[model samples]
Target: MKKHLIAITLILLLIAGGVIFYLAQGDKAKLAAGADTGKEPVFTAPRSELIPTINVAEVKVWTAGEKPVAAKGLALARFADGLAHPRSMLVLPNGDILVAETNSPPRPSGGLVDRVMNYLMNKAGAGVPSANRITLLRDADGDGRAEVKTPFLTGLNSPYGMALVDGTLYVANTDALMAFPYKEGETRITAKGRKILNLPANAPNMHWTKSLTAGPTGLLYVGVGSNSNIAEDGLEGEANRAAVLEVNPRTGDYRIYASGLRNPVGLAFEPKSGALWGVVNERDMLGSDLVPDYLTRIEFGGFYGWPWNYWGGYEDRRVQPQRPEVREYTKRPDYALGNHVAPLGLAFADKVKIGGAFANGAFVGLHGSWNRKPAAGYKVVFVPFAANGEVSKAKPVDVLTGFLDADGHARGRPVDVAGDAKGALLVSDDVGGVIWRVTGGK
Candidate 1:
């Protein structure tokens, strides 16, 4: 009789699991990637799932001669290879390129969900330890390939963003803003760096990449992401998180430039207006297509709703202790880059050599998706801009692709995009461990 009871219980559990799996796959995206873009993204009724869709592309190393496909009139080449998880890049005035070869810091505890996600990251090849160094690549002959490679800076704590203003070089680490004295054409920096200011990086630093950009106003803008998805760990846990910080280079003092940005990874300034802009990664678990990541011209003392709302005024019902009043003032983003694209890099075409439609626009490195079926954003795309530096209404055009093969495996994952002095575009592929250069077609 005991054996019979055990068998019945097991059968019931199996049936329940089957039903859950079916529900998870029931809601497919009703709109295409283009439809869910622009100033107004198509937002469906939030379908909360007990288990979020898990569709990460398996990581595969790029075999010899394998390269990402550049768009028409452009050519792709391996600028520098065999790097360790390069996440960001900076082009020096003297033509040296600095690559931040790093990854996330140790994750903090968040319960069973965190453990499962960590396991998935391990399987996806993102679980490797952080390299924690910046390397320099130089193409002395302007042949579009880096021949001289050297370790530029070492002993970093999962650095992501880099900028050089005047004679000082700034690096945004996972926990703090650090600065080093820099000289033009120098291959490496052995001098110790000083911590300018502490960032919001407590345990469970889920959104770990802290991107930095130097503004013409002498302020350094740091993009710090939220600690949890929609403050699942409680609102009290989100102090000074989910916001852009403006730091004074001289004194290390800082203030919140803007708030309610979930994960503003790429910080940049619009060329014509000089307005600060960012590409933000929104929250998840609200179906695959509900919340779209966006590119926006950031406003000082502005709020782009996060835990309480999204895309201006759509309340997320999931966040507890709702602030309905705050939704009244939530600022809408400038443009949507589709949902779950995980946009990690943004750069404007100041003096673009890659002509045609991409001559004067923004280059976005979409880090790809892991939550949506038939995944999105495994490439770099160009958003055209008018002469005044305002993004045009045109849809995004592919600049670099083929990161995922026909078998749906990721040969490379693009993290950051930048333009070198020669006007060629540079991309950092962390998973495949390479730096790809894109030049204009002959």
Candidate 2:
């Protein structure tokens, strides 16, 4: 009996070793990063994985005197430091900056897969509890660094996007759209928040960050991500999700502005044509260079492919109950920012005075990727745009870099990018707890 038990144990160990070997030999990218970028990206065939590649960079906070490298002819400075996990920023009408210093809400435990992912995420410096507040930063002396930092709004639930429309500030929390009365030059909001709309944030909210932007007509557009990766949680679980919603702030009524976006994190309106645009994080586990995250014009009542298809009708066999009809209407994205870039923030350069190549374009904050080998997108990039509000054919140009050290340990991870009143770019580094300012040469 003892010999038999030993044989069984040895067999189990052999099986585990085999599984590890297979996962270690997971799909690799044959094409370079730029090959899967720009207006005509080369999409490779999907190489789905039973266990996706997990190559998260261990977090290492930046020491004093350390900062990101700006492009040639540009300068980088610390706008605000020593803050909680800052995710997004909004430039108030009075030139004050409001940053949402928050993190993910408490997530319920799943099975073994989720347990492993949680452990990896924590190691990547994203496990901290939500700060649940927006902090105000004022650079009153005009020296780039913030002089007065104070709590602007407190006791909120993982707030992210913020927009001021018609004297009211709209905050998109993880599960609801909140509104508060506001006035110019005020540092704090003592008024009670009104819950304008409840967003889709059910249990296991895989993508919980809701980005808000105001349209030209005073309508509010909110970017709601998918409940699950590729809708594996059943179609019923994705009702009104994976799409951008236009909300009426007064009546709390909303409609699906566009459908089939996997995770639209950043929304902005083009300055020239006033067309709404968004940066979408595409589906993962399809190898490293298959599906590229994209920036595209958000047309009303339009559909971009999600679970069923990708990159304009490239069918994903893994998604069940395939709707072949949906492929006919899948709108091809305008520009590909590269696969697994994880773009989070989008701001046009209409107000940005950074000259030369940075003159006419949009700034994107790439939050970095955990699934891709060699790690991609821990920096800020600028995608050039034409004068007519169309995306140029040029590949994205790096604006800020060196977030990772020689050992590939992440010193910081950028989350959002917005232009300050003085025409400089403000980048929120969530992991390093700093907001970096980038200005062009004099």
Candidate 3:
């Protein structure tokens, strides 16, 4: 009788798994892929799922001679290769490049849901252990490729963002902001990093990556993500999170500069107006088309809706004890990059000499999506900005393609974008472990 009972339970579990797989596959995207992109995208009604759509592209790293397709009149070449999940970058004053080859820290197992999500992420080329180091890539011969690649700094905790200010290098690790003294043309740093400030990095850090940038006034800005998706862990856990914090490097003091940005992974300053801007990844599980990720100018003390509202006051009814009043002050983003594009990098085109339509715009690295079916955003795109440093109503132009192959497998996934000393664009492909240089064609 015990044997029979055990057999029956196993069969039931299999049946349940099959049912879930069917439901997940059945949640097809109703709107077209790029329909929810641009200044005013179509906001379809919410189609929340008990099990959100799980359409992840399997990872197949590029073999020899494989490369992404550049846009018309643009040339592509490998800048540096054989990296380990290079997520962010900083080009030094002396033309040396620093690549933060890192990933998420170890996460505690949170029952079956967390385990399942981990499995899915592993399949999507994101489950590897953190590299915990930053590498220096130097091109001494004047060629585009880096002939000297060496470890610049080590013993970090999933460092993501990097900046050099006033002869000091600041790195945003998953849990702390660290600083190290540096000089021009230094290939490596052997000194220990001083902890400038502690960031919000509680356990099960859903959005673990912290982006950073230095303003002209020498103040540092760090972007911190929320602890939970839609405040499921309660609002208390999100204190000083989901916002950008301004820090004084001299004294280690910091304050919340802006609040309620869900996951501002990429922080940059517009050269013309000198205003801060960011690309945010919105909430998930609202079907494939509900919440569109955006790029916008981040104002001081500004609030872009998160758990309470989205897209300029569209309430997300999922949160318990919703703050209906929060909608009144919710600021809409300037431009939407479509739903679940997962933009992770933002760079202005002010110093970029890649002429033509790419001259006066912003280059964004859309890291691609896993929660939405008919996945979006595996390439880099250019969003044109006006002469006054404002993003226009025009749609984004694709700058790099072919990350996803014909069979929907990802050969590479773009993470961060930055302009090099020579005025060319450098894109980091974490999955393929390469930095690609895009320049004007001959």
Candidate 4:
């Protein structure tokens, strides 16, 4: 009698599992059919008009100087176009490029309402036109070119940074830390996973994309931007905004890893030292030199003062009567990029072995500056790290440039950078709506 009961239960369980699998497959088919079909997508959050990345009518190769090929070592091979605002990129283990389009325009160009919408979002503390889907591009045929395209994930809220852990995909979406359950060869995000954690305060009255990176231990770290450039700064109000939070994808457990960082857009774990590193975009509206963007290692519970002190000893007069009691422990950034140079994308380049100046260095994509008297940072630069994984009196080399033209105009603004499984660095341009994959080292 007991054996008979067990057999019946086993048969029922098998049937239920098969049904779930069939339903999942059907859902993927429906999602893929809708993705990138140029159809209007429904959303869970409020929609606004501020699309930033411009989709070029044609893919053109641009060089810094008039000679077109003046820089022999550096060349931008445009991989794909028609992206709304390709803010962040994740090169998959299988060589497919996953691009997060942040705030792409509807009609493909700016409209009056769209511009107003963007402005209002910025004013109200949430800003920019953001992408709702993740795009997958593959050169499946190996024809020395890529012609295949597919939408991998959709309804993501301005997803910025992507980290693949074990088999799961962890995305840092603005206002939330999200996850996609996965396994090898899975086409769709079959499982919704978890919202994990929600961060409403990171809404950018200023700069907002909450980029994230996973470390060696399967721990996910997120970057939450400030409510405004350097306004009230939520010194004691919002705890996690303008800070980095380390998270566990499976369990949805989280903790504040660091604080007082204003918009740490890009983050990575050091290959040699196993330390967490981040590149931050400091506040604006002071002078070009007042608040310099920074790239530094993230220390737990460390404070890099914002709305008060910036780049170490430079006290910001705008936020006068600064907190005198809590100023001692502020750890100044190890190094500073040029003033107003918005450094965002970062990756520890141990895997990609390049010779010459950048043989043993990291690459940072400087998303061009806004409100600067002189425009700054529309290129990818290299910073050499010593044997100890620290910057040792090094200067940055321009690896990717020409986004700003001869007339000092910006063709595109770079947002994020990542290395492929083969060590090729990929740069995503939000302004140009394009993706450029840079391969260095054999």
List all candidate RMSDs to the true structure: 4.5, 4.4, 3.0, 17.8
> Residue 264 error for model 3, in Å?
0.3
lDDT of 4 by residue, 274-390 (tens): 888888888654443345677888898888887577655456656656765556767788767655577878876775544466667678888765534345677888888888777
- Compare the candidates by TM-score and give the number of the best one: 3
RMSD versus native structure for model 1 = 4.5
Query: Which regions of candidate 2 are displaced past 4 Å?
Result: 1-25
Candidates 1 and 4: which is better by lDDT? 1
The digit string of per-residue lDDT tens for model 2 on 75-172 reads 99999999999998999888999999999888764444454556667879998899999999999999999999999999999999899999999999
Q: Against the hidden reference, what TM-scores do the models get?
A: 0.93, 0.94, 0.95, 0.76
Q: Rate the local accuracy (lDDT) of all candidates.
A: 0.87, 0.90, 0.91, 0.65
What is the alpha-carbon lDDT for the whole of candidate 1?
0.87
How displaced is residue 59 in candidate 3, in Å?
0.6
- In order of TM-score, best first, we have 3, 2, 1, 4
Residue pairs in candidate 2 whose N, alpha carbon or C atoms collide under 3 angstroms: none
Error of 4 at 203 (Å): 5.4
Best-to-worst ranking by lDDT: 3, 2, 1, 4
lDDT of 1 by residue, 1-442 (tens): 9999768755655564455446567656777658877765677888887777767789888997999999998988999999999889998888899999999997643444454566668757798899899999999998889999899999999998898998999999999999999999889999999999988788778888999999997889999999989998797878888999999989988999999999999888888889898999998988877789989989999999988999988998988988999988999888999988899999988845788778787899999988887788899998877788787788888999999999999999999999988888999999999999898878
Instruction: Give the Cα RMSD of candidate 2.
Output: 4.4
Give the lDDT of residue 54 in candidate 1: 65
